[model samples]
Target: MRLPLTSRRSHHRSVCVLLSALLCSGLACAQASYRIATEGTYRPWSFKDAQGALQGWDVDIANALCERMKARCEILAQDWDGIIPGLMARKYDMIVASMAITEQRRQRVDFSDKYKDTISRFVAQKGTRQDVSPSALKGKTIGVQRGSIQANYLSQNYKNSDLKFYDTPQAAELDLVAGRVEYILGNMVTYYVGFMKTAESANFAFVGPDLKGGLLGDGNGIAVRKGDVELLSKINAALAAIRADGTYDRITAKYFPFKLM
Candidate 1:
């Protein structure tokens, strides 16, 4: 049955409008949702709790940033060793783990401006009588996390010293407390919040000068794909807003006695 020419034209217009609406909806969904990857083992940064849910300073900060950006965020756990590779493979839109912004890493992925700065220090038993000076630790074994800037720094600067690499700082700390290693190198903030707070670490003391820049990189920042300038800009804006309104300071204070941002 042939329809009138006017009727056919009107029907075609309606179909076109429906298709446009569907496409627009799909695009909006895509823009509103993104995935962020984190290493679930790093305590006080991003780690799973006894309830089996992710919790930490970075987790909270990421949630706040997503809220400010008005975007839906799905936090995924990934191994620390493969984090950068996973981002390059498009497994996640961003890395909110405590990633140091070093030039070597910058070559592989872009990083947002540092939202936090932490000093690296060496820790040992309180009464161990161990001198933490670079010269004093010369032949002693030092433990550091594998694939970490701390490992790079120790290798570069302490060539003559014996180096032991662990998969995580927790492992290295365990070894240090067990007397397997002379000392452990890691962020002072992590040690203070996670390790030093424990009764077992009552005999531990942080030593050495504050480690920064050089192999340690500028500071801790979020990592995104190299061409994700738009997403990076959004995150930076959110971070700036949090800092300007003192939200960042409040978060920092919860974890430490002093401000880190």
Candidate 2:
């Protein structure tokens, strides 16, 4: 007996599908796919431009790591208010955002080795020089991003001062511009490249010393859910590869004039 043409084609299709699945498992399609979450409101680290597309150092680094790992990566713009909670809900597989590696955060998620540093900075209207100490800022209102190390530092050390925490850095910047706050605490690189150098921020200048380590903990790192140890290891390997092969430097130079990593 001879098979009908339609049946012959159906049998061939099944075999082709099986072969493709086998190939994907072993060869050209071995690359993994991951979804990354970033707080898109932090400019120079991550934010949307006039066209509403995401950009900045975090986006660049995330893409680079995805490439090095041969993985398809999708980045989502999540609000800082619920970023960590979203991760716990399995909304994303990783966080390539400029999240600091603090002990408190480690209890919930695992982090790759420090891929970048975090330096706190204080900015105010030009010629406004405060000592950046409890005595200097006493009774003054300072602006900080809520749930950030800067906010934590202010609450812990400058208890005498009134600290205003915003959901995003841009909101804090707005308050600073409107004279709602005496000073703004933020990331050093961002305060310089994303704001102070711009014409609108011409009236603003950095005051006090660059801060690191203490309450800020270690540097920035990519974060994964706790127990996702295998994925965390792979991310660290990609980070190391990019740094050694000059990919890291190339990306860093595009946004910052100085070495930040």
Candidate 3:
């Protein structure tokens, strides 16, 4: 028989609170396996295959990190917007998505040292001929992934442009190709290797120069709850080990042509 709503809520809280308490108590929680999160919609970074299995660089890196840490980990697919909130609620122990390390995010969570450093770029139809300046994009719709650094950059620097937000970067690119948006801003590697290289993107080209720093922050890092120093340390150590031992290179070669770490 099902329990009452209040009873269910109380039970959920009790279990989460207990887990939170253990997680904060030095390495008590680390003794157990970790629940890692990744946005499975992002290709090359993390995405689900036709059979619904999560595959890509982020998943591989997460597995490598778990192996180096000598810990078992289960990678769960989480929506990009709720990824951090899910971590805060203890739904997952850590986030291994391509989440950039920014000051705004650091207030809510602690991040492991950066694992990948890359820049952002704008993509538009070939021969479209428009710069990223506000005047050039004035009434044009610029598609971007919601809650991403590129979205923030567009909102702040191109105030006159029309912003279209999508839950995933691929959605925005789809819209761009469908003639729904004049341009889309996102990770350089994502556009270059993930999208532009594909046959569907034959008509698209990178516009403007590479964007970095100032809001984009310092690349991607693993995010853990604040004050979860033990877990953070372990993740950082594992990342360093993988990079030093050539495991990172092997993973990188499978996804990207050049080094990302």
* Structural similarity to truth (TM-score) of each candidate: 0.86, 0.87, 0.86
User: Tens-digit lDDT track for model 1 on 1-261?
Assistant: 988999999999999999888978756646478899989999888899898899887888898889889999999888888999999999999999989999999999999989888679889877755466668888989999998889999988888789999989999988888889988998888998888888878788987677888789899899999999999999999999988898788877776687776
Best-performing candidate as measured by lDDT: 3
Higher-scoring candidate on lDDT, 1 or 3: 3
lDDT by residue for model 2 (1-261), tens: 888999999999999999999878766586688999999988788989999988988999999999988899999999886888999899999998889888888898999999989999899888986587889999989999998888888989999998999998878998899899989998988888777876768798888987988788699988899899889988999999999999999999998899986
Alpha-carbon local distance difference test for all models: 0.88, 0.89, 0.91
Assess candidate 3 and give its TM-score to the true structure. Answer: 0.86
**TM-score head-to-head 1 vs 2, winner:** 2
The list of candidate 1 runs beyond 4 A from truth reads 1-31, 127-133
Quote the positional error of residue 6 for candidate 2 in Å: 22
Model 2: lDDT equals: 0.89
Candidate 3 — worst ten consecutive residues by lDDT sum?
A: 23-32
Q: Report RMSD (Å) for each prediction in the order shown.
A: 4.3, 4.2, 11.6
